[model samples]
Target: MNVEIPYFARHQLSPGGTWISSRQKSLRTFKLADIGEGITECEIIRWAVKEQSAVQSFDPLCEVQSDKASVEITSPYDGVIKQFLVGEGEVAKVGQGLCLIEVAEDDTTHVESTETTGQSPVKTPVQVTHDVAEDTPTEAPPSVNVPLRKHPLDPTNDLSGTATTDHVLATPSVRHFARQHGVDLAAIAPGSGRDGRVEKKDVEAFISKVPVPDEVETASRQQEDVVVDLGRTRHGMWKAMVQSLEIPQFGYSTSLDLTRIHGLLPTLNAHIPAHFLPSASTPSSPRISHMVNPSALYPVPQPPSVPESGRFTKMTYLPFLLKTLAISMMEWPLFRASITPAPAQDTNKPTLTIRPTADLTLALSTPTGLYTPTIPSAQSFSLHALASRVTHLAYLGRQVPCGLTVKDMPRRGGTISVSNVGAIGKGEGASPVLVPGGGVAIVAIGRAKWVWDVSDEFYRPNDDGMEGERRLKIDVSWSVDHRVVEGAELAAFVETWRGWVENPERLIAVAT
Candidate 1:
């Protein structure tokens, strides 16, 4: 009897009389999944896998740039890439097809038509991987043929003869370093780094050992200027700064005495709670009680413990300044207010939305870019807790591609922003700019220095009575939205802040 064979099972008989079943290849389009925080689209920065290349599940596919962060997209299927629907430097919307993958189908039940569902092929939910180009290691590009040249150190001319460094393994940062120094990576082949990877030290060593000829040095100096595109972060800043011009702002400059805080810093550092110390594994130290105390009566409260991200061995004046600012913010409601636009019906009647809690934004400069991460409800936190939070925020900012997320930066930013320019330079004064929605005001704190105060109001006559007392002071400049905050109000607010700063003991009195 003759029987009909299944489509998948149908096979051809070889010359050896052996039946062979053919594996059919089906085309499937891999779509871009939704990356969080209401992001609609992302720019394809770089592709990790090439077209027609085979990839395994969980293999990195491409890196995309969003407004907030850079995320690495990974493949969800084990297949060969058939075609790239979207190229690098192009923006792809969510749910859009990224590439066509060719998957093998062996059984009739598993066979699928060559059609796309227009949905992400990722089996599991998409997750954001913040591995920037610098952090992610990738294979070198194709090598280029170059004319042979002799090296002073290598008499055989084998080590630094040709510029075939395209195959040399190095990170994007190391490559940038080589470019900046005008050194060919191929000349420094067989890098001393692990697994023959080129490192910054390797580039430095190459620069130190390889002496450049006067002719070549002159040619390098006369090289053509190269046009470079601004990164996503810098581009965003450019737009924000442009928009800031529409807002009316006024600048206020003043100096604060920090001698008292400087004197108190050593005591504060020495008395940092054990729980907040980085070396402390446990929350609290063991305490022995001479007499038994009831849970209801004479109850001893446990001290707050610091998270790993917020742990610190020593304290600085910045935290004290932040705490004092929070107190001043609580006292002055206008500083804690955000401007809300008027309703559609009433275009002229805008309102100020005063937040009950004191939210503070800190201007942090990272390798990636400038980020203003907020510390919500700063008034509720004690001095130690405030310091821990600041430490945690800074740690997040320092990470590669930056660890700061939407959580670190909320929709409604801090009503007031602070930038510690003093940490970097010795500038005594600055004219800080204020951007719309950046809060009502922004302050730049400059370096602290000792200055002789001739005013009799602050200092009393010493034993000599001939010279004035020396005071440690720091310069602070404020730029406030003049549309909302009057110049007098800004001065009055600064004076109120000075009260808390001058008498930091009040912070300890009201410690949580």
Candidate 2:
């Protein structure tokens, strides 16, 4: 009768009858795990570990960038990297193998074995053995067995016989630079970057080496087109512009006499509150005279300290123009109204939501993009306060990534929007476009210029015997949703605003 000895028992019963233990090496395919939030795939931006590199558990393996954010992938087990399944710039889907790692596994556990006997096979406890080698085929875990799709950016997946820019190894910014210069990245062979990766310097070198005829260069420059993805703010503008097509708009252009405000600006700037002035230039507070009765003095209360962000030492004509516009909007409620969608039951009759206060939106151009921040209840704010708010908005617009938030731009936007295009250009007028929900009206204020007032109403003999007086004037173009605002009403509204603008004293009388 022969009895089969268990593999574990045989190994344990050595020449000295002592137990022995061993660890086996196994190949594991490290897969890209789900990095939360409905993210299905991400592009491998950089690899921290290279092929054949040793790594420990929790060590960073690679960094991946998704549509939302960049995340770093880490090793799950202590192992030596065998091969990379995904290269840099290549996208890997969740559960897809990212790389193969050789890990050591202890095989000292007991397994059940059968021994052949005369009647039936008897079960015996034995050790499980594994024949894993360095070149052994690696099997992905069952959970990561899904078929891998060929990524478009993968070089091996390109079947085109010719090399194209898409197949070149370069970053998105490098590609953009190449595109802008009308240089074909595919033409720049043997790039200077590591692994022949094309770079901005390589593109510049290519351009410098290649010379073309002047006419050809001009023609190529005209033909070159670079595609850019619109930013968040610009994308919003695109959608609004598209919606603008649904509404009928009419434009009205006219001139405003800024002769009075021009003189008033210097006085306003000189009297800017100490709080609004820069710390270096802030004037010392005046002390009360001892001779005056304390009761008669009435202690002139100081205005609230202006935040550093909102401080401004100088005032421009824009604040006064905006304030007067707000006052006019108060008189003409239609200009202060926003169009609201009709009720589900009554789709034909769209309603107008009239806001009691004039919330003004300024079309501010920033480095990031165009932003329209609202100045709520513009009429209620004093001129100085309005100027400070404008300065604060301008400051916010200059920040990187923009500092304006939803609070600065609420869902319920202003009734009318103003764009001071004149600040950057010497344009006389502009036909501003009015988008739905942007407001009932939009106006572009052009650059102001000094001109002789030759009109019969204002013409006067000057000291030099000239028939007209030198006056400062600015051009303003208005575009309104014709569906809600008639041409006559818009003209009348401008006239009402002009009443406060031409006679600047009225603004001070009604100043809050």
Candidate 2: tens digits of C-alpha lDDT, residues 343-448: 9999999999999999999999987678888999999988889999999999888864456655686668899999999999999879899887888999999998
What are the root-mean-square deviations of the candidates from the true structure over C-alphas?
Answer: 13.6, 13.5
Per-model C-alpha lDDT, please?
0.76, 0.77
Residue-wise C-alpha lDDT for candidate 1, range 371-443, written one tens digit per residue: 8999999989878888899999898888754667667887689999999999999998998888888999999
Per-candidate TM equals: 0.62, 0.59
lDDT of 2 at 34: 58
Q: Cα miss at 23, model 2 (Å)?
A: 28
Question: For candidate 1, which ten residues in a row score worst on lDDT?
Answer: 123-132
